[model samples]
Every structure is written in structure tokens, then in C-alpha cells.
Target: DFRPHDEHYVQNFVLVTHGLLMRIFCMCYFRWTVLEFDQVWNPQNCEIWVLEKTKKGRYRLAGSWQEESKSFGPIKFGADKTKLLYPHMKESTPARDMVPGKPGWLDDPALRHLVVAAQFGKGIGVNKELGSLG
Candidate 1:
């Protein structure tokens, strides 16, 4: 649920299942569809995606810079003004965590790449479970 105005609208992101810890990150990209989407949000509408590309799932809504990622301390996006690194941001806090409306460059792949690279410090570590987002 990463949608700002509509909290319970957007569904599915990252599902990290390491050993017994199955963490759900709404910032990560989807590995696929159907099962994963339903697991994230039961009775999810395939007609509604995240921000843009409704049928496309906005797969990489967060950012894609985890191709060559490394290990880091406990993941936490502390004191991030734009909440670029914040975990489960859009779902955590609507007013603070997310931008009011969709920006013009949101769908731009090149600009998106730059933004994602700048925000993610060490890059996404759970790219295995989540899609590459490239």
C-alpha cells in the first residue's frame, strides 16, 4: 500500500522470505504477478496498478539500483526528507512519507534511474526475491 491519498489502494511490492523472516517491502519491484499480487493484497484488482501503467503494475515504483548491491546494517531510512530510502514509506505515513501528487518525471526511465541511484545508499539488497527493476 504505497499510495499517498489512497492508503489501501496500491498493493504489492517486495516480499523477502529469508529463513523464517518474511518481510514485505512496498518499495521493491514485483517478481511476477497473480500469486504474488494476491498474497500481498487479497482480492487485488488487476486493473489498478500503483502510480502509473495500471496494467503494468508500476513494477519498479521505488527505484532500480540493486544490480550490484552489498550488505549493510539494519535497513532504515532515518531522517530522509524526501524519504528516498525509507522502508515501506508510502504505507507508513501518507502526508510525510509521500509526495502529494505524481511528478512529471515519474515515468521517465532515465530520470527514474538517476533518482533511484541517488536515493538508495547501498542499493536494494533483496533483489533476489524482488525483480531487478532495471
Candidate 2:
């Protein structure tokens, strides 16, 4: 069963997905921003982590997620603080055509093919109980 807070987790996952997309496949012009939200029931329970892709083709945690209860920063989580980083668009493409924008092609099922094509196989990390799964 999904908890009441599951929706927040799902939204976080969507943000992570967009971040991965911008980092790997999208052109360098695109910028990504992730803003986490705390559950209303618990003010101190929320977090926002922002990952930015540098010019050198590497992802970096742009800033700390932890902040005072109502502190302001590049990324904020609230009803009024929803302006994440603006995504980049190609020279010929209009700003409205960018991914995650209103009515963009990223929602198409055909994009699933692109995602599968870009996926790397699972890694061979050591398992605590089963030991090496490789």
C-alpha cells in the first residue's frame, strides 16, 4: 500500500529522472534543478538536492540540501517557490518545445525506446549476504 507521503516520493523520482535525462542524453544547453519538499505533517522532514552538470561532462551536487526551516537559496520548496532552473533549447527549437515543458514530446511512449537504448546494464556491486553477485 502506498502511504500518504508516497506522492512526494514519486515527485522526487520524476525530478531525478529529468536530472538523469539532462545529464546523459540532452544537449549541453539544457540545465537541470531538483527541489525537494518536506511533508506538511513534519516541517523538518523535507529535503531538496540539486544536481548540476558541469561543462566537463560530470554531475555535481550544486548545493547543500540542508537549510534552516525557512531559509532561502537557489532551490526552495514551497507553493510559491516553484521556479526551478530553466531548461535549454536548441537554436532552432522554441523554448516551449523543451523537455518537461508544457505538452512536450518527452511524455510520448516512443521515448521509452530511447531510454532503453541509453540504459547501462546493472553494476556488479558486492552483496552483503550473498557476497559478490558478479
Candidate 3:
């Protein structure tokens, strides 16, 4: 039960299975944006797609580098076309993380590879699940 602006609109939904720790996020858009459009659907703007992890174990939205404030971590792009990393970034706070090494959580080879691959738009033998928009 996830809604962007209003709960009644119900633009997206997320469900998680307790036992398996499996999670699924489904987005219903009024119009298809570049980020969600696929060839098969051919939907003008209204469409829905589920963002899931690849077989390689990387989440769908992982590894999209974006500008961030010096204080906070990486800035993330929002559905409303807004950049959201640090809600309260200010001049006094640091602009970015200057450490050389990658984040400790992403030390795994598979994760690093996936990040590199996604950044370059190169397929890494991973398949995306596609479903009907209607």
C-alpha cells in the first residue's frame, strides 16, 4: 500500500514475504517515463512495472551514480524528478564522501561487477521480468 502523493491514488504497491524475505515493488504510472518504458508494452503513459532484483542479486535501482551534497551520501533521483539524498544538506556539512574505497557493503565482486555493468548499460547475462501494463 504505497502511494506517491495520495493514498487513495495508489500509484504503487509493495509486498514483502516474511519467511523468504522476498520483496516486490509495483509502480503504476499515469504515463510511461523513460525509466519504465519497455518495447513490448507500447503504453503511452499509463503503465506498471515491478522492480526486482536480478538473478545476480543486485537490486534494480542499484548503481545509478548521481550528484550529492558534500555532507550526505549519494543523491537519489525521485519519481517526481527531484533529487533526494540529504533532505537538510547545508553549507556547513561535508559535500561528499572523500574516502577512496568503495562502500563496505558493496565489497563483493558480484555486486561491484553489477554496478559497473549497469553504469555502462552493458548486459551482464541478466534478464528482466516483463509483464503486461494493463
- Which stretches in model 3 have alpha-carbon errors above 4 Å? 1-44, 50-105, 122-134
Please tell me which predicted candidate would have the highest lDDT against the true structure.
Answer: 2
Candidate 2 ranges beyond 4 A from true positions? 1-45, 62-64, 69-131
Error of 1 at 53 (Å): 29
Which pairs of residues collide in model 2?
Answer: 36-48, 38-46
* Cα RMSDs, all models: 16.7, 18.3, 19.4
Winning model by TM-score: 2
- Write model 2 residue lDDT over 4-85, tens digit each, in one string: 5776433223243343343333333332212111201111323454555456644544432555754334443234444332
Among residues 3 or more apart in sequence or in different chains, the pairs in candidate 3 whose N, CA or C atoms overlap within 3 Å are: 31-45, 32-45, 69-95, 70-94, 70-95, 70-96, 71-94, 71-95
Candidate number with the higher TM-score (2 or 3): 2
* CA lDDT of each prediction against the hidden true structure: 0.30, 0.32, 0.27
Candidate 1 Cα errors over 4 Å, as ranges? 1-20, 25-75, 78-116, 123-134
In model 3, what is the error at residue 12, expressed in angstroms?
9.8
TM-score of each: 0.18, 0.20, 0.17
Q: What is residue 40's positional error in candidate 2, in angstroms?
A: 23
